[model samples]
Target: MQDRDDAITPGWVADLAEIGELVSGAYGHYVERMEMLPGPMRTDYAVPLAAGQIEVLRADGRIAGLLVLVPEPEHMLLDNVAVAPWAQGRGFGRRLMDHAEARARAAGYDRITLYTHVTMVENIEIYLRRGYVETHRAEVNGLHRVYMAKRLG
Candidate 1:
């Protein structure tokens, strides 16, 4: 991990669980698969946050988004990104994504990779617009996933 502790605000750590709630509807299609996933791992970014493996974005003095990045030998894995529904379409998602790209670049990583559920077509389109190309598709943990990546300049 990149030790993102200093990059995220302190108070926001406690609100990640709350932030996780923002994506509940987006994950509605995965009710069954979600159950297949271990309890805490289901939309919980606690592990990554505590490990300094991700960053959180706040808006109006509150937690509005989260970016989960896992350090890999070849690239930074964009494990997850979620923006509060109320904060959606307000540029928060792009801001966090841009930050993730910069973070990856600064870490000497040439790429950033991520995956979204196939059912979440909107997310797939958003990532595509951000320049992430689909690398392949896979079914993991009972969920159909589309893997994507962006090469950093």
Candidate 2:
């Protein structure tokens, strides 16, 4: 487990990029397993926001993972989340979700939302375990995508 109170710094960009690549590869695998197009992950979307992104670092100062929040009027959307391949089974994703929920509660937001491909059953299960429920499902880019929401009180 990682300490949540540590300050996030800008130097974690390279680690974040590596994590993004891992995520993209994982997503591509999921898509292929479901017979969908293996579209490229939008790494560019992550670049400009590097300074404002949140990261979790190990005790030795290695970046463990990152979660990007896109603030909105009604709620905070989990725009992106990635954990390094080496750190995948260590509950880092859950930790990031916990941190995001806390931030949403502190900001007085009523809900948190995110979207993931329907074929990504593992990811969907993780969200469900964390109290998110599917709010909608739609076909996008030839794949079924699910939108989920969790109330933050």
**Each model's TM-score?**
0.80, 0.76
lDDT of 2 by residue, 11-63 (tens): 34455565556557445666557775533364464563564655444423555
Worst-scoring 10-residue span by lDDT in model 2 = 2-11
- The residue-by-residue lDDT of candidate 1 on 1-153, one tens digit each, is 222322444324666656566556335445675454422237556667678876676666556677778899989998877676777788888888898898899999999999977766788899999899999998876777899999998
For residue 107, what is the lDDT in candidate 2?
A: 79
Alpha-carbon local distance difference test for all models: 0.72, 0.68
User: Candidate 2: which pairs clash?
Assistant: none
Judged by whole-model lDDT over C-alpha atoms, candidate 2 comes out at 0.68
For model 1, give the 10-residue run with minimal summed lDDT.
Answer: 2-11
